[model samples]
Target: MKSVLLLSVLSAAAVSAQPKLTLKVHTGKGQTGYDVNSTMIAGEKDMLVIDPQFTLSEAHKLAAEILESKKNLALIYVTHPHPDHLFGLAVLHQAFPMAKIVALPATVNAAKTGWPARQKFWFPTYGNNIPGPDPVLPEELTEPYLTFEGERFPVTGPLQGADGPGNSFVSIPSLKAVVTGDIVFDHVYFGVPKDAARENWEKTIDQIAALHPAIVVPGHQGPGATDDMSAVTFMKRYIEDWDKNAAASHSAAEMKAKVLAQYPNLGMEYTLNDRVAAYFPPAAKGN
Candidate 1:
């Protein structure tokens, strides 16, 4: 009996010794190929959690770290409108009711309505392009309270090619970090700028670049961003490549196949709802 009690005490101590920020990152599970982090903002008692991990349990797990460490849950911020990025919102809210949800006004509006349009476009046309119903926020929050209007490129929408709401950015003044969501998919999605933004992709990047946050919190990676800010250049390069290939690959299937063949890792970007095989074609035609 005494041995069991001693073991319990040791386990409690081990849990107690782990840092709160470290605990926020559950390396064991709930990661959908993304590294989640809840930063230690300078002035806020409650943390400025970025992305909030990948699952309901993961959100619960993040909340558990706060509750255990006695930290206030100030707000949960989503960089953009992507499933793997924001699936934890409902769970986080369940744990931290008072915590406000923050995002660019456009992100909120787009997430509320834009994703569904993409769903409609892709489902019947392609059948298995994406995996789930368009992601909807908890019905309780109607209007986005916080707004970030990037002056570098103002958001005027034709929403041309991509169904994403609009490229938008926000500043966590306390953290000095700009939450850059799907607008910036690191170096990986750089080749497919149109895949993310149809209308104002460039403008959004300019806005974000103008702020030049000391640190940037992208949707799927860790902090300390030294590169990948050359999104505009990379995107332009991608468009040039696409145009060069357009003479031969005109159909959507051809475009899809070429994209997959060129970047095999991109086929790895699918969520549970996305189609793995379709994303990667039998071969890059004219091989």
Candidate 2:
């Protein structure tokens, strides 16, 4: 029994010490994602980074893993305005200043409008546990512009869609895929907050699908087809259900039962329960 207990303790320690697995999307050198494997393009000199992982510790660990491949991480592309895919950047930037921060037409514009408010609101609920990066104050920097999107964007006339359909794109012809931001989410959870509109999100996904990328690197989740069709399908279904219930219509208990009944194989533990409570109406207790 003592021997068995010792072996179990060793096994647990080994598991805890194992660094998080990263999915590498490119055939190139050390350029790989630390967690969900970011898509990278290898140049003669440097490599371009897709979205970094979500937390500071995750980013630090990811960086150490990349150094093992013996390549320099050059640019960072912020996929969209969502905090999960884009927040690790502040610390990453401080670590790799040479790397450029790139994005779409309204990417930062959306963040500029939403992040401050979200930071304020989310702090009350999640702040105490979140990894704090002490982001460089927004104004302390001059944001970069996209080369394809033109120095002064909203390129009028035929490309008016730069902010919409005909949005600007970044291509590392060598890689055969663009690091699409939140334009694509694979087998993962997706719930939009006030800053993001479902319709706008859908539009971006449609545009990404049009790109015909062989390996589309979504902002979150593991790398997959840029045209991952399932996200669109799942999102559409959720929207339909959400619309039917209309935020305030369902009581808490009914909401929980409805979620369990409909998505029996869905969220485990308190996560699903919390989302229901946070996003839905209160239960008619003792009913």
Candidate 3:
């Protein structure tokens, strides 16, 4: 009996001493107007993926990375309902049939409503570059933590951020990392919806900064932009600058010129004009 007790203790100790998980961040192409991000969280026996990506081609590439990991995909978490974030779910479903996809109830509703409109809008620009506007809506997360095999890993939020309402982020306590869906952008143009709530988004940025994560994985950015907290800083600065410029500028052209001057290297210039128009419509007939 003593020998058996000793062996049990030894086994438990071995399990406790195992190394913690390390996360991997994958960035899709920037030219798509939505530089989507996908994060993989690995454990000893399985892995979890966050926010697959935009196009079918991108999802295929993301799946290939997971397959190469040789770890069972335990679950997939869709952070938000934006078409770029949720539209590639069909591809992931084909790749990881066994993995359960989870999201907040709000995200599901938003995805359903936005899917059709986005399909029409993107078709002309993306052509056949994207897969089904048909997204695999996620099963609502019934519990506070995600379970892999029998072990539990805690995930926080339906946390709203930069992309507005229904945006969420995933925090892996073990990895000291947070996968921030559109709450943050690194040197990328933030989508300014026609009815953007600037104050709410700024508040969300504060909430994210409060989390004090050692590493931040933004929803849209290039590869070099991941694994750093600078995205948070840049996003805050961008919003502040935008608000300032929008208030002072007379037209979309003026706002665009001022913003581009401030952030010369920021990509998605085409969208910048749209954002300006959203906030400050063209001055009517040279008033």
Candidate 4:
């Protein structure tokens, strides 16, 4: 009789410790031509968010979702300093003041440094739709992990990329998942800048692949989290193809044509053309 009671108590405890995670994805079209993803992870008692959406309207929608969850907003993790990733944080902060907003130290610094310039650049395009409220500077993520209801949420990397430092991922081991920011891309064409460190980005991908996350929440692209390798594989192919062809091309149009011919189905041709023009500009006349 005592043994049976003990077993029941232990089983209940185990179930409580391993609460199921309810994931909600808020997707928005970035003005820069790619999609942005903001993932919300709700547990039994509290909820955590990863990389809130890109605009005020998108952030409000995400905030609404959090309000509907009816759980304590525990934390908001900004994966990197990119405007699309950090711009919506202020909105989330206003809605959930108790929720801790944080990121890797370097990421926080980058966000602070670039916020003003980015606002200037994007405001004209987004106009009244851009971030108007004062920006909220996120606190530094001092620890390497987070805990909610006694479950572990480990963070990894200042993953270096062509875009420079400040890339990171949050691993929910129990769920066998990871929220990868810009380190991995989905079906969209990746933003490859001039002097991008292609080799380094490849190494970062290998590092993420090592985690063997069953579900990936990529920063851009579609379908939200999925148990597949399509995102990683597609990103690898895109980068390699770009690297191989970039040197051979002399003009942005030529590069765009070459890449589009190879990957006609890849969305965001405008982004590709913009990157090519910005990185591989045409030589000035009479040079």
How do all models score by TM-score? 0.53, 0.57, 0.83, 0.84
lDDT per residue, candidate 2, 101-124, as tens digits?
666546556656666766666456
Reference-based lDDT, each prediction: 0.48, 0.48, 0.76, 0.77
Model 2 lDDT, full chain set? 0.48
lDDT of 1 at 135: 67
State which candidate, 2 or 4, has the greater TM-score.
4
User: Which ten residues in a row are the worst by lDDT in model 3?
Assistant: 191-200
lDDT of 3 by residue, 47-164 (tens): 8888988887888888899999998987898888887788778788888899899887778777778777888888888887666556578888887677764556555566556667
Tell me how candidate 4 scores on lDDT.
Answer: 0.77
Ranking by lDDT: 4, 3, 1, 2
Which model, 1 or 3, shows the larger TM-score? Answer: 3
Compared with the true structure, what per-residue lDDT tens digits does model 4 show for residues 1-287?
99999999999989776547867666776554247888788888799999977777888888888898888999899989998889888788888999988888988888888888898898987765667645677898888876766787888878765455668888888777878888777777777633446667777777768878877777777433253456887776777788777888877778888988887765444477666776586577986
The regions of model 4 sitting more than 4 angstroms off are 1-19, 30-34, 193-196, 223-227, 244-250, 284-287
TM-score, cand. 3 vs. native: 0.83
User: lDDT (0-100) at residue 184 of candidate 1?
Assistant: 55
